[model samples]
Target: MSAGTAFLGSAGVLLIVTLIKLWALRKNPNDPILRAVCGTLFIGALLFVTAAPPHLAKINNWFGTPNIAAPIVYCILTAFDAVNIVLLIHWRGNDDAARTRRQTRLCLTAYVAVMAAIVLLFTMGDAPVERLRDLDTYYANTPFIREMIVLYLAAHTVAAVTMTVLCWRWSRQVPGSLRLGLLTIAAGSSSAFLYDLLKYTAIVARWSGANLDWLSTHAAFSLAGVSALLVAAGFLIPPLGQGASSRWGMFQQFQRLKPLWLEIQSEIPRTCPKPMSWWRSMDLRLMQRERDIHDAVLRLGPYFDASTGKRVYAEALAEHAERRRARGEADASVIAGAVIAKATARPAVSPEDRWMLTSTEDPEDLVRMSDALARSPRVQAIRRWAALVGSRG
Candidate 1:
């Protein structure tokens, strides 16, 4: 995608996520740390929107000043950085509640002062033409404008560097999803630092009578755009990505267990006396299927023969060992399949009296066992066991 498109897309995604988070926050309005985090994300989204090309001009016109969106964008970005610092402090949790609040207040107060300085400096500059996408480079040498650029850059540099250090240290301490998210955010912060340094250097070059406008106008802005996208992804991955991964896993388990559930369910109709309507979620369906399978196992308990289970398990293990598939994973499936096959053949004693010893909390073992039932050897062995049981009866 073009750079503008990428920026808009990233900003749009952040806005959508921020709105969702805000809606959730309505349920727990008293959560201070969570509110700070959402505030950081929300301000970052607005910064991106104001920095976008089309919105930049509209914002400038609304403010009735040429390139006026520049100060507004910087102010929002300053707010974003301040809130991010607050979030980091809260996440670190090394400071007491009062100390954390003091540190947050200090950071916010400093950024707000910087934001005011930026607006006052911009207003003092004499530029009348709008330079939406190139405001910094366009005013690189102007008196008040040059100082304004340096002021915003200095504030951004400090924030970015602080975040990089904090996030890197915290990443080493955290594990799993939190660690991953922190590292990603650190990378984004590092990118922001680079963008600020480049822009500052370019402005300084103009003061030294060197025309390095390309660095500030093109390269640094490009880096800033990339940093924005990365920061959005970093913020989103831990919560949204993990949730999506969980849902996807549940759907997969639901699909995988279906064949086995349907097979056993055919023989024990009362196990699932009623079917759920199609409109229900797959996650709910998976839960229902698991419950039905458990009920069916109980109904088939009288048919279960312990000796048959032992024999089938031993034979399957030996056969799979020869095929080099009887290691860690295959071993469990062999045992579960044999037990389930034996249960499918024995005569019913009392349906209400028996229960499977397997854990209902984890369905992985049950899924494996169901998968093994469809194997040709296991199916044939179950038939033989049923015939033997019939003859004995």
Candidate 2:
């Protein structure tokens, strides 16, 4: 891809990622991890925007100084390196607050030093010629400009290596989307390190009187652009993937509860409005269904009997059903009996006469009970027995 296209594409991706992170962070504005990641992404986008050849020339002209964009780019890169390290340290997460603070301070100190040195060297150096795309090679032999270039490149190169090693290592320890994101970050960091290496090799070759400016002017730029896209994508995947996964799971849970929900609504009358398209968040639907199920459970509480559960459980085991499935079957029978008793208008048992299974009546256990209620023939038989007795009552 062309350098302008590469730079622009990377910048656009970063800006989009940054906006997403910012939106997510608003719920907890004090989150260090989100803040760090957000800052790094924004800075990276800025770096790419400023480093593009046309932008570099425009910036130099804007300031009315020859090669002035060089120092600005270097300072921004140095800042990007510093912020990235701070993010890594935060991402790793140390338990010791003091140690984390100390480490963060040290990284910031080094970053400020690098930024100051870049500005100082640029001021001291005289590069009157305007060399936008090939400034590194063009000024490779200049006194102070040489130091400024080396400083930023060295900092960025070190950050790249650190990012590659840490992210790759951490990826092994994690699972799911986080692991994938970390791996992508490692790839991007590796590309960045390669770009920096090319720049270094090209500059050093100039000192030896060889022409290898294409390494910096072409190959390095392309690699840097590729790195930007990879890193932005790495940051994006984890949150987006996790959000999608959670929504899918919630959708499944909502569907699972439907049979039981329909069973309750069929016998008992409650006015529930159909959810509109905008009201169709899976989580909201799941929560509302859980509330309805729990309400039904409470109304049918008096119909549950302790002895019936034991008898049903014993019968299930006698049939050689697996332990968990047998328990689910037993629970299903008790719930089924309650539904029958309520429908048949059986008189309520006293509070002291009521009994429930050991299982907490949470949504998870309810799902299991509902699954069994929908499928188990044994539960049907047990409920038939209860219905006969309930008919007598």
Each candidate structure's TM-score, on Cα atoms with residue i matched to residue i, is 0.73, 0.90
For residues 313-369, what per-residue lDDT tens digits would candidate 1 score against the true structure? Answer: 567677765322222123333234334445545434344533333423457766665
lDDT of 2 by residue, 1-393 (tens): 766677877788788979988898898799988898898899889988998888888998899999999899888877877877798798788999899989999989988998999999999999999998899999999999998999999988888898899998999899999899889988998998999999999999999999999999889977876786677667667877899999988888888877777766643436655433535777887877777766667667787866667787888888976776667677778778777777888876666656665433566767777787788887778778878976787
TM-score of 1: 0.73
Over 4 Å off, model 1: 1-10, 20-41, 87-103, 120-134, 137-144, 169-180, 255-260, 267-280, 301-347, 350-358, 361-383
lDDT of 2: 0.82
